[model samples]
Target: MFFTNPLDNKLRKWGKAKQELPASVSAMKEKVLASVKPKAEPLPKTKNRTPYWFVLSGALAALVLFIGQYTLRQINTPVADSGFGIASQEQMALSSKYEEENLASDMVTPNVTPSDLGIQYGEATGLGGRSYEDSMVEKVSNFISTGQDRNGAISDAREFLKYDYSATIKTRKVEQISSRVQTIVRGHGGRVDNMYVQEKHGYVYFVVPKSSLEAFKNEIKGLVNVRFYTESVRAQNLLPEKVIIEKSTETAKESLASLEGELAILTKEHNTRISDLQKQLNGVVASINRLRNEVTTSTVRQEEIKRDISRLSAVQQKLQRQITDENQNYNSQKFYLDDRIKNAKSEISNLAEQDQNLQDNVETVQGSVEVEWVSIFEIIKLYVPYYWAWVLSFCAIALAVNYFSKRRTIEAL
Candidate 1:
């Protein structure tokens, strides 16, 4: 009863081992502390040393640049808003004045020399000479070669000098006048721009160079009856407009070049996209072809079905017509049979009534006949004695006569 358990003895040994472990841990911590060394402190950072003047100078320069750019933009804004960029208000006013002066001067004819008109002519320049065309060509060449200022001066000088004349020639001989005018225009080194002819009138529009205009008018004056005549001079200042057009043309050329570059890039991208799209399109086309084939087969089948339906419909219609006809025939036969049966029934009823009446008449006739037969027998009995009496009287008379005859015969004998 006093024996100790084995588990209790083991628990006591475990408690003793745990009590010895703390002394071993303290000795290990003392050895680690004896081996360790102390660490040094980190160094401090230095402050920035740049001068304030450098930053101030940089800010001032940026401010000055921004102000200059803003001022420049403010100055250019109004000029840009005006459509004519380089032309000033003074220049525009001068051009308008020149236009007005030219318009006024165009109404009156002015004495003009070949040099004043900016044309060059030789001594042999005439309506009948080939040098006239040469002189016109020279004038055009000189006008082109001269600068804008000189051209403007020349244009002002020629403003009232250039003449355009139109005349209505009322002549019955239109063909002859037309031929003569054409010859005159050609002889003056001019060309016919337009010509129209009618039965009663003819019209001719021709252009003669400034050098030949007077000669052309002189030649055509007396050829036909001049009904209506008009002369107009072209007097316009084109220098300012020409400068603007030239500038605009230059800008347009630059823009066109830039646009062409962009277009080239776009075209390249478009070609790439198109190639990809073309591959997709090829697939789509293959699909479409397959669909088309399916559609064609389906269409064929649909057509066959439609034909079948149409045939069935036609057969159905024919059967319906046949049924209708049969119904009509059956109805007709039924009506006829019904009418016959009704008539037979009616005749049978009438015959039965007639038979009943005949039976009644026979019975009445039999009764009357029996009564008449008894009456007739009674009458015959009453008549029979008279008939016998008459017969006996005649027999007696015949006996007397036979006796007399016998007596007479005996006497004779």
Candidate 2:
């Protein structure tokens, strides 16, 4: 092999008989290798080696975060497809149902109402009794409140005292009795509730409220003959007990309806458990029916059970008498037949003894048969169900009442 290196020629000239390379020469070879070695191809473009798993992981993380946010949003706000909020829906429904109803008062408010308490008090003074004029005219004016009403209020006062009045011992009608009667009543702040003519042709009866009653009677006194007639005056105050249970029950019903509506939406959209929803609907319907039955007014039923019982007893007595009569007749006939049979048996025995040859034909048969008489017990047994309808009706009413009371309590909550 021919070598092209001039270094080898120089090495041959200096070499005495082919000396082997020393350790230093090996070091020099290593240095030459270090210098001549080609550099590696820059780690095979490692920056571009982004792991497929890393990208996938990043996308997955972002998707998970997005889903989490969506879930949170759905929970916080129930945005319907129509975009109207629940409050708006409630308002619209209220308007449609009640026709621009006044808004319900908030729970936070104190007691407020339209009614005011009325009172009347007075002191008696001077004579044995106050003048009839003062009691009828002045008292009414003081008692009635003019501030409560804006419409022209009445002021009951006697404008005229002297007026025509006639008294008749005999029954008669005077064409013209008094002119001041109408004027006096009109002057006093009073209105007539009702006027009645007494059995006596000349007597008149008037009934009115507290402030108006006195004036009304006084006016009548002025109109007719002033005779000493029984004038009775009495006052009555009615006490009212108010129950708000109905309103409470109504509110609960509305809440239940709202819950039902939400449940319906869930069923329509998400296909939620239909069985559970149907069960709830059944419960609600049952509650409604129960309440309705409870609220139904019951009418008193009148029956003549006593009369029916009395009639039945009479029939039973008649049947007993007939049975007794039949028994007595049967006993009498049985006793007569028994006597006849005894006589015939004796006659047959005598015949047997007297005529031995004819004894074979002398046999006697004597017996009595009884036909049972029909009884009334069977008839009453047949009618037992018909009469028990009243009892059944009572039980039904009781059940309805119980159902209603329980349902009302539930609804009120």
Best by the TM-score measure: 1
Per-residue alpha-carbon lDDT of model 2 for 217-279, expressed as tens digits? Answer: 555544433331112221111100001222334454565555556545544543334344445
Distance (Å) between predicted and true CA of 395, model 2?
81
Error of 2 at 352 (Å): 99
Q: What overall lDDT, based on C-alpha atoms, would model 1 receive against the true structure?
A: 0.52
Residue-level lDDT of model 1, residues 283-309, one tens digit each, is 544554454455345678768655655
Please give the CA lDDT of all the candidate structures: 0.52, 0.40
TM-score of 1: 0.22
